[model samples]
Target: MIRKCRFAAMLAFSAMMSTAALVQAQAADLLSTLNSTHVLTIGTSNDAPLAYIDPQTKAAVGALPDLLRAALPLMGVKADVRAVAMPFSSLIPALQAGRIDMIGDGIYATAKRRQVIDFTSNTFYNPEALDVAKGNPDNLHQLSDLCGHSAGTYEGTTYVDQLKQASAACPAGKPIDIHLYPTIQNVFADLTAGRLNAGVVDSSLSAYALKQNPALSFELVADYKPADKAGSACAFGVTKGNDAFLAGFSKAYATMLADGTAAKIFTKWGLTPTSFFLSL
Candidate 1:
């Protein structure tokens, strides 16, 4: 019986190794296929600064796409990196369903998301903020202040999960009413219409929107630090098991950092840089 047990253990180990090898092979084949095709479809949101449609040219152009155009060539990928602007909530689904090759816009690699999709190394970091009315009627500043109020944000974003967590932690079981919208524009519209007291979003995005519409009466109610230790590190989202693509993409990204390309991209968008990681 002991010998049989040992044989079973060995068989299990062998099976595991075989599965890993198969995954690696698939990843390599994917890279080769993409290289031969000479094009990579990138899914992004109309979230300004990070990525959005340029009003003048009607082309998708922003920090994320600019960074990709600068670094992809270093990886020997001389392809037309096309950007497809879609609703914020739809980017992930499109990536997972093979409708797009990658997610170019800002996506936080939270533990829950990591289970479904893979992320490249940390590209940049920014904190969450509360976008309130111009005169600060609600007097909101931090996460706790949102406990009993209505909060608006885009659906399927890290902000939504953070707000939910904040609501769950409210004292005396008084939860905040979290309202999710399909796009950031909807959140802004509701906020302007007095439908929402505040909207939780990335601080940088809030700044961009406020700048774009100077007449809009919206003000950021101070930056809020989330309880989650990860904070908000943005990275490129990719299909799970695509290890070959990740490896090449990560290496090219490092090259960008070494040569000062990364800093320029962030500065152009008015966003600060984050710590580097070969993998997230």
Candidate 2:
């Protein structure tokens, strides 16, 4: 009986080591798969100009998708990139769970996140802006303007914390009424429908979204003052310690940046690419 138990333990140990070796081998040469398999699974959110599933064609269309399709092949190999759309809050967990190979949801690689995943050089910087009904009906020109008014932002964004902080600073009886939505598009929907008094929006998204829907009732507060002038640094995410994927991707991206391919991608998406925003 003891011999049978020992044999069973040995089999379990062997199986565990085999699985570990397989995972490590896969991690070691993600770049080579670009040539042989030609498929890279990218996880993203339903955010426009960064990434979103097109309603008509049902394919991912945006700056990051375009850049990946254009730039990855410049690495001297073929790369067939695919984008998987998920909720804004599900991106990181999806990446960590290995449900996707990379994340391109305009995700920021802050210090806390860097501990779990590696990131290529920043892809963009997103500054926050304010939006309100036309003619500035609520006088919502700044963070302080949120008091006594219903305001909202996309969930899982740093902007949510900013809105909360602003709300906490409001007077005891008339705090900012804050709400969170699954996507920025939903937040804008509320604003246009007159359900939300104001919304904290991304500046680039402000241009792309409002331009796409000129008939929306709300308008960007062009002169809205913000508590923080500097915005967030956004990047593409991959599993931590995957050096081949990191080095190969960063090299390909740098090539695009030098050749103006990145700029054209941004311009086609209605936003201008900048060195300050797109570089190390």
Candidate 3:
């Protein structure tokens, strides 16, 4: 009995030591390590104009990726930013799972999301808009206009909550028919096909798509009133509680904002810099 008890105690001690080592490994500060290792993994989606993988070159292109690339040298981070493309909804989970070092997409820095992940300072302000078939057939002008109509947006976006708010205010028996897709491109696809009455997405994203494909027979509601009083400030996301990385990256990002790097990136991507981006 005495020998068995001693063996059991040794096993328990070994297990505790292993658990402590795992916790320490998980909580490691990734900033200095990344700078030394020269590799950083990022998660992005098919969110174009902000971030996307170019099909032809298989390179990550767009305003967000460009900004991230520019900030690297400033922070002395020389890591090869490997871009991992996934559905929009998977970015956060992958980050939490330690599969990606950062998120290279235009994730809005809202209070709710901040609870789960950290974000760099606001990089740009983009307003929400309603995209509809050409000529605004249904005359949907604002959030409330979505009531009793088939409206769509991508999963894991702020627009989902916005649509729900509009639906709640709708008259009894008249709720906005909300549909969720994997990506904004899917939403636009159904909207142009006349399957969905409207699509609520970032105004800048919609405008960028139209500029890229003029034949896409959809139009933005002119003089549209948005559900929120103003737009949202979007930024790259990182794992929560990553103080070392967030501190270094945020300072470098601020330099990018101050030194005109951010504006130049937007222009390079055919995006106008007259918006609040310059002010950020």
Candidate 4:
């Protein structure tokens, strides 16, 4: 009888141990599925301040990356910033394809883009401007001056739309000849080569370019005015249906703004401090 009882007890013990092992395995699997690897992929064309490549490190390091780094940790996310060098036109398609998780580069929220991808709260505000050649040969002062002149702009940008609108309103026989380039550098190169009369771009970018090329002597001839009072606010583009990620990001971003961290980052990059969406 004693030997039988001991055998029964041993059997029970073995069963409990087996059950515990099974439970642990199940728990681990569940955790693995729930905890996604946090990676924040940012697309860039190397525009300064907004998004640019560090010449020495050859890595994307700019205001956008800094802002993402500050905000991600608050949501218990470990952000891995990956910079994908691509043309501005390809950014939306890349986001839709899941090639990138988000765009760290500054992108304005347009009604057309909103149809495809959702934009997070505004991170910065940038005005569109024109870059004219040295000595202001054409004496260009605004969009009206582009009439009958060849202008260059990055493909797939709102600047193209602005140029088209301006062209439509010009007098007969003075239509604007706007040239599109795959990259900003290409457009600048053409402008310098005299292929283009002017290069229209974001004011911040125009400032940065002029600073880099002292001899280029380019100046902003016009500033873009958004159709709405909201102005042109830059935001991160995220895939639709990721409500959880968006909510978390917004929360983290709000926290950063409330605490002045966002302002510091903006100041570091020489950007004007502006309120994030939540603060507004």
TM-score of each: 0.82, 0.88, 0.91, 0.79
Best by TM-score: 3
lDDT of 1 by residue, 38-85 (tens): 887788877888887777776768888888888778777777767788
**Model 1 pairs in collision:** none
Residue by residue across 1-280, what tens digits does model 4's lDDT show? 9999999999999999999997774344211222466555678877787777787887768888888878777867775666887889888888777677677776888777889887877776766667787767987877878899999999988888888998999999998998999988888788887888888877667666776677664565644333433556778887665566667778888888789888888777665434422233
Highest-scoring model, lDDT: 3
RMSD of each: 7.4, 2.7, 2.1, 9.5
How high is the lDDT of residue 160 in model 2? 83
Q: Mind giving the per-residue lDDT tens digits that candidate 3 earns over 89-205?
A: 899999999888888886778888889888877777777878999998888888887789999999998888888988999999999999999999999999999999999988778
Candidate 3 segments whose C-alpha is farther than 4 A from its true place: 1-13, 229-231, 278-280
Could you arrange the candidates by lDDT from highest to lowest?
A: 3, 2, 1, 4
The C-alpha stretches of model 4 lying farther than 4 A from their native spots are 1-35, 55-58, 222-229, 272-280
Q: 41, model 4: CA deviation in Å?
A: 1.6
Query: Local error of candidate 2 at 98, Å?
Result: 1.4
Instruction: Give the C-alpha lDDT of model 2.
Output: 0.80
lDDT of each residue in 1-280, candidate 2, tens digit only:
9999999999999999999999886566567756777887888877788887788887877888898888677667676677898878888899889898889877766787888888887667777879888898887788887888999898888788888888898998988888899988899889989999998978778778878889988888978765553447778888876787677778888878788888888888888545534542
Q: Assess the local accuracy of residue 167 in candidate 1 as a C-alpha lDDT between 0 and 100.
A: 92
